[model samples]
Target: MPSQDEILAVILGGGRGSRLYPLTKMRSKPAVPMAGKYRLIDIPISNCINSEIFRIAILTQFNSVSLHRHIYRNYHFDNFHTGWVQIWAAEQTMQNADWYQGTADAVRKQLFEIIATRAKYVLILAGDHLYRMDYAAMARFHWEHNADITVAVQPVSKDEAHRFGILKRNPNFQLTEFAEKPHDPHLLEELVSRDDPQKPYLGSMGIYLFRTDVLVDLLNNYPLDDFGSHVIPQAITTHTVYGYDFTGYWEDIGTIRSFYETNLALTRPNPPFDFFDASAPIYGGTRFLPCSTVYDSKMKNVLLAEGCCIDHADIQDSIIGLRSQIASGVKIDKSIIMGADYYARTDQVDIGPIPMGIGQNCQIEGAIIDKNACIGKGVIIRSFPRGTDLDFDNWVVRDGIVVVPKSSILLDGTFIGPGSKD
Candidate 1:
């Protein structure tokens, strides 16, 4: 097994997550909050740390202020230990005047620094995925096979193959052909194996392992700007590329619907991705807050974080974030309420008619209330009656769920449902 010191992990923090919409309106995709308490970047960072790979770099470009702050404040290594996590934001220099054109381009821009690390292998990962992986095992697989590039792939359904890069591997797991989002059914069928017709296609997980020399040579020589789209296909013809099959829970939280579903899944009795694992725990910033106080509230299947003050309310299958303030007679179900940044002071005046947090008698269902939002009294956030998408003054109906933007205020008696008019 290769020592952790021989590998350098680089997490690719993606571009403006337009699919996640209003959530990414303020923060980068990787910096987006998840499970109430942790950021999306924390998943990969935590995994790398747990795998004993300490030297890491996060490559970010769009809306990186919050991402930078969270990384700087939380991750620190002692002088005695050489392990450290750092951020490599996009910059314009004489050599490279443009921003990161694509994933491959991002790494090319930072090639100088990457080569400086002097690591034997490079592990590239996506920042917005949710899963627990022991990368050391993948590294061992790569070494044992003597593969030039090893791509971590998962068996996805045939219907979903169109959304990801599909690959065909031989009996030895050596990648023979690669297709980026194939539209033709004939080509898709060719990618699948003859043995298992059910899971015919192997979708690339955007996780890659490469020998240091191979990675440097490919980036320096190829004009390709994307791995799945360009580099991987070309490499299959010349270099030895292998696919490592990963059978585990992995979800790319790229779209709003996926993000919403993933969060709600945490309320399940036994979620596929468990955060309660003692051996491989997720790490985040430690916020010193008082214990949550629930007064006369009827709650079930809720993951309430620290510093929450819940009054007489009914909550079920929800994830309440830190310092969430739930008032009396509020009924919440199948919702994710990201709590306020700080407590609303008694003397602090409201910026609008509604104060911060969910107001009294508000009935919210299948909704995602962003951080620091103010829901006024008697507000009803539910699906539209007419099943039509509506973007109101305070919220928007996305994937049939009410999404209240960060710091938005819904005025008193605001009723948003199907067929809401302007």
Candidate 2:
């Protein structure tokens, strides 16, 4: 039983997330924790669920164990008879090589499953971003225009515009040109209508709505490879690829700095992303825990999730993850602590300290520490997590990010510094 106008959505979650290094060293980018509470993939899934699209298949590869576990534990929906949210991992039986090479190839290999569903449109979206959108409305717009492909576009600043897949559209909303990370904005404006392009140049959100047969044929007979590299560029001239104007909050968390900034953006008094929307609620796995408690702590502008304990610590502009514990007199500012075992573990690879500290009396200066560090009392640790100058005289300077492996235990009274020994 299928509706004639139903569209299938495919969430692309196969990137190696190398830019989010250290953090992504163990977990996939989509599964990485965000705002100290939700995973990166939750944003898109919540959007899809809120949009009332029940049939979804998350395509994952490359360090997908954590991502798979996260979806299974939190977002599996079994209520709808025809709605099935499935996960498609790269299988050796289907491909002679490793995991998916690119976004287009990821879907092309599994085009059969999508075709079998008999959906009219196939929606492809990226899972590594922070945004709240009504995809259902976007889908309706696609049908309203009878477009071969409808891409979500938003306005970006001139300096940052070059980093995105900039779109050029006419008054009729048809895309005339598509360029990936172009250097010149004026040149990009050439593709736009003469009227007003620079003031509001369209940038692709990587959220595409493709006609089922069109997508199938493109995957079958298209001479090119990836979507951005081949598909969209080729389709612009031959097909009616319209640009759907979307004026919502969209942040691409491609690098560590961007990811950190996006998380901090949520701590604002009124965040752009309202996860509690009543009409389109972002669904998450149920957690049974009491809300966080702060006692004698000087905390400001921080987001504390349930099952957390903060005691006598100075915290500002930081995101505390689920069930994490911050000990008394421990001061943390401009840092991200994903796990809570920092104060109890003893096993660590110490090189030198630009900034590292521990113990009840330890005073830590400004710097980053990864996670799962054990510091004994009365030690001063700063942001410089590793000291590498001693080994090669070329210190592994702290990128202002302290990364500790998961569940690392620290012994009391141990002094470590800015770099890593391991």
lDDT per residue (tens digit) for residues 77-131 in model 2: 5554667678898776544366677899888878878989888888899989888
Estimate every model's Cα lDDT from 0 to 1.
Answer: 0.90, 0.71
In every candidate, how many clashes are there?
Answer: 3, 40
Best by TM-score: 1
When summed lDDT is taken over every stretch of 10 residues in candidate 2, the lowest stretch is 388-397
TM-score against truth, every candidate: 0.97, 0.85
Best by lDDT: 1
Q: What digit string (tens of lDDT, one per residue) describes model 1 on residues 1-422?
A: 66778999999999999888788988999988899899999999999999999999999999999999999999999899999999999999999999999999999999999989999899999999999999988988899899999999999787788899999999998999988888998898789843666777899999999998998888899898988898899899989999998989999999878998899899889987999999999998789899999999999999899999999999999999989999999999989999977887777664566778999999998889999999999998776432445566668877787889999988888877665553
lDDT of 2 at 273: 75
